[model samples]
Target: MRLETEMKMLQAKSQAGIVKEETVGNASRFIDVSAKHTKLPHFQDGKDDLDIWLTRFERFAESNSWSRDKWSSSLCALLTGRALGCFWRLSSEQAQDYDKVKLALMNRYDLTEDGYRRMFRS
Candidate 1:
């Protein structure tokens, strides 16, 4: 009976993890879809354009007095797909910046100047 209880507990934990992962995945997809529809100045590549978009977003967020959490979440939603594909192509420092931004968003309203490094990392 104890073994069975432990197995059930493990299964519950696994299911909970899967649900969290799905939530994150859905959020990532939302980001991708939003990015696809956003209009921007013409650029050579989508990945390059993503940088410009992020800069514009930061400026807008600042001007509007957006909270750090809002800015981070919005940026993550915008860059999620592009980040996955282009991050590896970026420099080591650039990748670190991306990770920082992502972590900040995950942590909520706690981003810093370092998080903005992603804007120039490309």
Candidate 2:
């Protein structure tokens, strides 16, 4: 009965996405029992529209129940070319902020309100 109780507790922890810490001798390691990692869409400069891509990314993140605070790092994984360059140019602190990163990308890609108006006029 005691072993069954422990197994039930372990199962509950797994479902809650808890990290298990195991220590052997003097060493300790963390085991991730979280859900499977979800892959975000990759952004390709010139090929993908920044505005549309960002919208899609947000939707995908929401659908996958990704933590809002982790979106910056998660989005960073799929950036490439000029988009990736813009991320790299940000200060370490700014890079960690999704809003700042999005702002920088929008500015770099000329997606501001005036820029959109100019595009529409052209």
- State which candidate has the highest lDDT: 2
TM-score versus the correct structure, for each prediction: 0.31, 0.72
Instruction: Please provide, for model 2 over 1-122, each residue's C-alpha lDDT reduced to its tens digit, 9 standing for 90 to 100.
Output: 99789767766675565756567999755566454455556898879999999999999888766688899998899899999999999999999999999999999999999999999999
Q: Which run of 10 residues does model 2 get worst, by summed lDDT?
A: 28-37
Native-to-model Cα distance after best TM-score fit, residue 110 in candidate 1, in Å: 25
lDDT agreement of model 2 with the native? 0.86
Error of 1 at 107 (Å): 20
Clashes of each: 0, 0
lDDT (Cα atoms) of all candidates against the true structure = 0.46, 0.86
Which digits, one per residue and each the tens of the lDDT, describe model 1 over residues 17-112?
321122464452112222334443322333454444556776766665456554444554445443544433455554445445544332332234
lDDT for 13 in candidate 1 is 56
